[model samples]
Target chain A: MGGSEHDDGRNGKTPSAVVGDVDDFWAQALVDVPRETYVLRLYVVGNSPRSRGAIRNVRKLCDEHLAGRFDLEVHDLNQEPWLARDAQIVAAPTLVRERPLPVQRIIGSLSDIERVLVGLGVSPNPAVDP
Target chain B: MDTYESKTPVGETITKSTNVLQKVPTGIKGFDEITVGGLPRGRTTLVCGSAGAGKTLFALEFLVRGATEHGEPGVFIAFEETAVELTQSVASLGFDLDGLVASKKLAIDYVHVERSEILETGDYDLNGLFVRLEYAIASVGAKRVVIDSLETLFSALGNEGILRSEFRRLFRWLKDRGVTAIITGERGDGTLTRHGIEEYVSDCVILLEQRVHERFATRYLRVVKYRGTMHGTNEYPFLIHAGGISVVPVTSLGLTHIASDERMSTGVPRLDAMLGGKGIFRGSSVLISGTPGTGKSSLAAHAVQSACRRGERCLYFAFEESQGQFVRNMRSIGVDLKPWLDQGRLQFHASRPTLFGLEMHLANIHRLVEAFDPSVVVIDPVTNFEMVATNAEVRAMLMRLVDFLKSRGITAVFTSLTAGSGALEETDVGISSLMDTWLLVQFLEGSGERNRGLYVLKSRGMSHSNQVREFHLGSHGIDLLDVYVGPAGVLTGSARQTQEAKERADAIARQQEMDRKQRDLARKRAQIEAQILALRAEFEAEEQEVMAILEQDKRRELVLGRDREQMARLRQADPNKQQNGGGAG
Candidate 1:
């Protein structure tokens, strides 16, 4: 609940803005919107293994650390390369944490779970790890 | 991609792989002439300069000129200035950027890069900039590109490795795409570009310098390197004005200008006579070096007036006097320059030598000469440039001016004021050799009077007089009086008058003495004739008396011989015959 996106019908409300208010049941899987949810964007280059691996690793790390309290949107830079200019994105498989103020970005396969969690300001779930 | 024509040789592909790099004319005034043709085509040229050295303006003018004149579309990638600021900055130069943009001939892309907004991820390759550039170029079909001040990129990116690789990539991309590019850079410490961009761009490098001396600001340009073409190596002065940046090249090609056989008057009849009755050559350069108040400016003014009278345009560059003061001063010397000015046949450009550097002044003269298309150009008192430039620099600038004017078949006259009394054989700055004709005006002081003396130092390819003529500024105009070379060597003013009067009196006294001697000889001849006549009359009277006395004696002897005559009559007849025969024998 950092800064809400204002849509004047030019573009539909982004998926991150649909926190727990949608007719789709999957959108309601998180029954209640967390007071502070993580907003993450994963930049990839189509269906390559490296992109799939980065996406899987980042999603696995996010689910274990902050399940039902995170919003993730993956973008294929090959299709939406113009979006890179906003963050001066240069490499593929870049993960950008856009919301919750003071955006942060990292470029890798996101294979190191602990580093990714630390970079995204998230802590692992102690009960799930035990 | 085919920026160059197919005529390029096969062996030249090493420089540019896709297209043969040709020269692209910048269309900047006096710039193309110096570069012999233009900048390297389809290649990035690095222009590095200090602050306020006209790097931005140079890049902007390159784009504008390409878009407007060469009919080539251009893209301006301004890193520091926005499109609105760029538009407003060049508005005074009469470049309608908005109109060009509306016509789709020019595209201005302002790339705002802030350190806070840009987050660096690993392995960045500036692909974002490339995409934007490609889009902009493809949108306008631009053939020319300008990335003004590439140093901003290094500062913004804050990574040398990325910047270097990106610079190389950008240059190669432009070359591959066959778009001529100009990349501006800030001057570095001990390097051509601030961030060492020179190491990346290898085709051409231009360096600009701005210096302040004696409270005068001057801008100079030099080509540090041009890979395939010959360029001027001297530091040339440039000017930034309403049009654009203009560099004045201080040298030209070999001596290939056609020497005209035509002649032009020096505006003074006697002066023309001294120049073998042909005055100066039509396209020759003349130098008039003299002391102050020696009619140097007047001589130049006369030449300009005569040229204007012939209906040929004339441009006068006055370094010491303003245009109004020059016109008024010429009027006082009986030279009516206002008429020619009003008629548009003559132009006067006056500025202090301290206003700019020597080369800048030369460039200004070159600009005016080219614009006015004048047949004759006069620079009054060229020595004033000594205040702004060294003697060597002045000479170099003058040599360029002379060569340029000579190539165009334009007559040039320069006046140099030699100070002090020791201006014997010194042409200030030793530029006398460049002049096709030199007139040395000097001061002749004698009999408590100062007069102007003019003599032809040299007139190449023509027979000029060796006599020194006295320069006279009269109410009717300039008149040169023949100098009197007497026992005093050369005399002028009252000394010449006194010497001439003495000579005339000596000639008249000589004639009177000869007339007196001839009259005395005639009197002596008449007296001798009277004496001879008297002697002849006296001798005649004496002879008559002697004859009468002899006759009386003969009658007395006859009476005495009468008694014996009867006896001697018979013998007398025979004796008389014998005596007559003896007397005849």
Candidate 2:
């Protein structure tokens, strides 16, 4: 169901071959009805542009892909700076996936939707073209 | 930035506001002396070294010493090891990191960077690291900061461009905070650090090296670059022991020690008499070098015992023998050191030279000297140090040690064992030049025995003896006997004894010959006097007989004159005439 909106205007410049692969993978994912709940936390530094962009991009990815099956939380490191050390955060605007067994982290603004999908394990497309 | 600046109190700002570059003392022994002061204040220093080069320990000592000695709080941001692991690792060095943390004097933040779990998606800044560092610093009110290896970020984040920029900002930020910071990095090929951290932190850079020479490891530290101040460029040997890192700044010890005019005895009165009739100068370095079994240790022991007898504390460093062995051996030479030991006036520190590197031995000696505060220090068999270090290195070490002891006004006696058949004047350790008094002892093999011969090779500022004396280690202690100088040259041991005995016998024979001559002269004078007496008696008898004949003749003449009585008057006249005739005859 989310396969149609996978190629948003921001990702429109991606090579069509990779887009085709992502589209096919998402299409197969719709038939499988993936029910695994996704857990994510986004760490940011105040109201910086990268922070705002990461927050927006990560929320959009979770809603468009997992929808109500995912839970997301946002933390501003400026207000709770100690959380950076506690969460082992080095760079600003980081996303940590804490659910579905082995945890994973993605650093930087989550602008590349395909890479975010592949990183979150939502899309089965192994070839992540960024 | 404004908030951080405001958080720094006005008092701190005023204290740190100075035109001249300020330094914070590191409190490491001999390190601050060479650096003149410590690291540049409120600036980042790059410490780069290979693995096991004691980089971590050096940084840790800076923090611990800052907190404990200087009352300055610090933050340790460990990137390689966790805080707990670091605590355990440095515990061996007697650094209580956890206790320091609990006392609010230190703060440890372990920044775990795992490259596998994290994926790079887009643009990001290392503000998170900054935030954590700032939090730790603010929480402890720290004035010193240690980021043990900032290079780990390159491997973890894999973004050189961003990481490099971030490092530049972090260093500047640390400076703005007015906190002295140390950033450690792994050594790289042809560079000070693997990640070129030196390029960012240009205030100061220190390189630590651990080299294995002849199977012995010695750590060296050098200041490669210092921005605003003069620094020692030589590679100083450093030692990591229970007391942490101690850098032996050998050349930095300028020859500025005061030359003392006072003298202390060398325990042997005869030896002291040989050295200007008083002894070596107080605070002077005395080198007693001799061949093996030449009573070098015994001479050193004599000095120690004499020092102890004067109620002055003495420290003995034995490299070739244990405490009991040395004390017992000295006892055989009548130098009883046990009483001094029991009285706490003497201390013995014995260890094999191979147990530690030359620098470590020097550092240990330094520590013991400081702790004991002895008036005299004896290092028996200083030549053993050659096994662990080169001749030049041993010389340098001894030079520094001599300088240190002189500065403290402590008399130092160093006994060196000369190798077989080498020049007695030239010690293999090459430290003779550093000594103020040099006593050379050698084995004189003659008359089927090896006897010890000692002479003052050099005594600075004093007229020392030039004659080599027979050094005897008897049960009554060292007695220096004048070597027998005869037609056979300098003879010692049984040869000297035989020569002395022969001279004594010759002297007796000469006395006997003089006595025999006197007796013969007395007998001849008695015989001559008897002959004179007999001749005088014979003359008297002959005179009497002649007088009797003359009387008989005179009587006959008188009878004839009486017959012619009338001629008596004429006889009286004739007597007067005869008297005049006799007078003429």
DockQ: which candidate is best? 2
Candidate 1 segments exceeding 4 Å error? A1-130, B1-21, B427-429, B526-585
lDDT tens digits by residue: candidate 1, B1-585 = 211113345335465454444799999877787788789888788889998899889888888899999999999988889889999999998889999999999988877665553444344445546655766787699999998867787766666786687777677778777788999998888988778889888899989999876566778898898887888887888888766787766665457889999999989888889898979999999999998888889999999998888889999888888989888888998998999999999988888888767766877787788788999999887889889876886787788888999999999999988875885567563888999899988898878999889989899989999998988898778999987997668999878888889888998999899998998899889888888888888888888888888888898789777755555654555787555543222
User: What i-RMS does each candidate reach, in Å?
Assistant: 6.9, 2.4
Candidate 2 lDDT, B1-585, residue by residue in tens = 322223544346446668678899998877888788999998899999999998888898999999999999999999999999999999998999999999999999998878988888989888888889989998999999999989999999988999988887787778778799999999999988887888997789999999998789999999998888888989999999998999989867688888889999998999989998999899999998888888988988888888888899999999989999988888987889999999999999999999989998998899999999999999987889889988888888899899889889999999988778867775443688888888888888877889888989899999999999999989979999999988779999988988899999999999999999999999999999999999999999999999999999999998986666555445665666555543222
C-alpha DockQ of every model: 0.14, 0.44
Which candidate has the top score in lDDT? 2
Q: List the residue pairs that clash in candidate 2.
A: none
> Worst lDDT window (10 residues) for model 2 chain B?
B1-10
Please state every model's RMSD to the true fold in angstroms: 7.9, 8.5
RMSD of candidate 2 to the truth, in angstroms, is 8.5
